[model samples]
Target: MEQSSKKSALSEKDGVNQPQSLSNSSVEVIKQMRRKQPSAQELIDGILAKDKVALSRAITLVESTNPEHLEKANTIIQACLPHANKSIRIGITGVPGVGKSTFIEAFGKHITSLGRKVAVLAVDPSSTISHGSILGDKTRMEELVKDENAFIRPSASGETLGGVARKTRETIILCEACGFDTIIIETVGVGQSETAVHSMVDFFLLLKISGAGDELQGIKRGIMEMADAIVINKADGDNIAKAKLAKTEFNRALHLFPAKQSGWIPTAATCSSYTKEGIDTVWKTISDYFELVKTNHYFEEKRQNQNQFWMMETINEQLKSNFYNHPEIIKLLEENKKAVQNDEISPFAAAINLLGKYFKS
Candidate 1:
């Protein structure tokens, strides 16, 4: 009887241990799901669930280039596709001292006061030497950064160009799904190269300094041609007259460049970001823009174009990654570089030969 009792006790002990082991395994699975980027369905469900943290993580995943995360990011994008078209994307750019940050701070606060949510993503060009970002937007937009209705993300140039972050398109999708109606993309104004932001935004606001007539002489005409609305910042006190003068010059210059896009004529105005003067007018102008374009079917067309642009960009990134991933190609490229340096082959010819070798299989 004693032996039988001992056997029964052992069986019960094993049974108890089994549940604990299974529970630990289950907890691990849940943790892993949390650590990974949520699937497209999970992203949509999380948005519906009002899970802001999950939404943010999903955006990060979409921006990541990790070979493992690509499929997950694509699925998340597809899942959130239905809920993604509910927001307005605004691209704002200006030269370094045009007060883009300060203006956004004032402008963003005003938008939130009307009970609308704002998300500002700054795209600062990465320094080639440091291979890191400057991330200056957070320091500049103090009030917007603190506002509950505002989400300000600093620039992430990250070995990319076009003054916008590589993942900004994906980030915008997630933000829109989370019910953010206003999305602002701030770019480092690198002259004509910054036009990449224009391809993605609903409105392109080019901020210029009042005294830029002198500076404009050196600036290219292509940048001015792309502006939908030009705002002269620092339009107060000593700069008022200069700002007005710039407004005239820009208006005259705009007439010379022809209209950009369909049914769009560039408009110029002046604003004092320090006092928040003319900020409301600026917003009203943008609002009027939506009214003008919505009726003409231009708004929808623009969104479709932007989506196409994102797809192309994603494919290009994938191709670049694949090209660099080939060990033989990399070795051949290094060898070809020395040959070119010794004048054995031209750069163009060397590139073609390497590409042919890479694709020969």
Candidate 2:
């Protein structure tokens, strides 16, 4: 009786000592998942097989600064390269109040509705100062985040802005290899970030709000010039008339800018993320632009030119990183910087001196 009671009772004496629920194979699988970082070939095969886990790991490798992972990262990228350039890279930028998050979520859902895989990459400001992202948009993107057809990632933190951009560009390749057809890059802040994103994307969309009174106050001329389409958001209910007026103003302003080299004219439109109105029209505009560029052969040419430009940019980034990280140059840089600050040496002369020493070393 005592033995039967001990055996049947769910207590530490029996249950804890010999838990039937803890399967050995399950434990081993969990341990395996935790223990191994997948190799480059494994990552490549997984990405090609459309595994998001593999794609995410490959991106982490690309973002890693550990010198040891560089070759492995390069291997993954080279393997993924042929599978890239098949997706359309779109960059969306706007000022803080423009509702970029809501717009993107709605836009992404629409794209996924068409049976296309979408990846949204954000260039958030906080990632620069803090290694971790502080994008409120991520939480706001609940629906899109839950969608299996969509993947969203914030900017990877880096020692320099160029490094951040480079990591993102590399991430694009991985996403493409993973079978994402539409890549949307969101610039979370204004300024040079827009320019950096513009270089990497095929379509540059500028989102704005209506009823600002001035219709164009606080908007940068350079941003307007770069815009392939200027979309006025919040165009619903009582704001509809205001949005239409703002759209007309933007159209007039776009006309003032010189013709784009692609020979594609910029367009102005309006959309409401709340109602999801005009979203299809915006996508149609993008499709029309792609058709035009592709038919004129400018699409491939632009991508080729961008590839060359980023190649040089990569070289510059590497050279600068190597020069500053060099032990001898690091010591001299501080001395030279202080000397220039104290007026003991000209800034240009100090720069030349550093370069001369760098090349000699």
* The best candidate in terms of TM-score: 2
Stretches of candidate 1 exceeding 4 Å from the true structure: 1-44, 212-215, 218-220
Per-residue accuracy of model 2 over 1-361 as CA lDDT, tens digit each: 3555445455455244656878999999999988987889999999999998888888888878788787899999999999999999999988787899899999999999999999998766645445665656669899999999999887643444532345888999999989999999987655667777888899999998887654757245877888899899999999999999898888887878889999999989999999999999999999999999999999999999989988998899899889989999999989999999999999999999999998998
Candidate 1 has an lDDT of: 0.80
lDDT of each: 0.80, 0.86
Q: Which digits, one per residue and each the tens of the lDDT, describe model 1 over residues 1-361?
A: 3555445543544243334435887898999976874456766688756566777777777767786776788787777768888888898988777788899999999899989999888877787888787777888787788887887767467766655677777778778877789999888877644677888889888888866554465234767777778888899999898888888877777877766565877788889999999999899989988888998999999888878987898799877888878989888888999999999999999999988887884
lDDT of 1 at 124: 71
Per-residue error (Å), model 2, residue 152: 0.9
lDDT of 2: 0.86
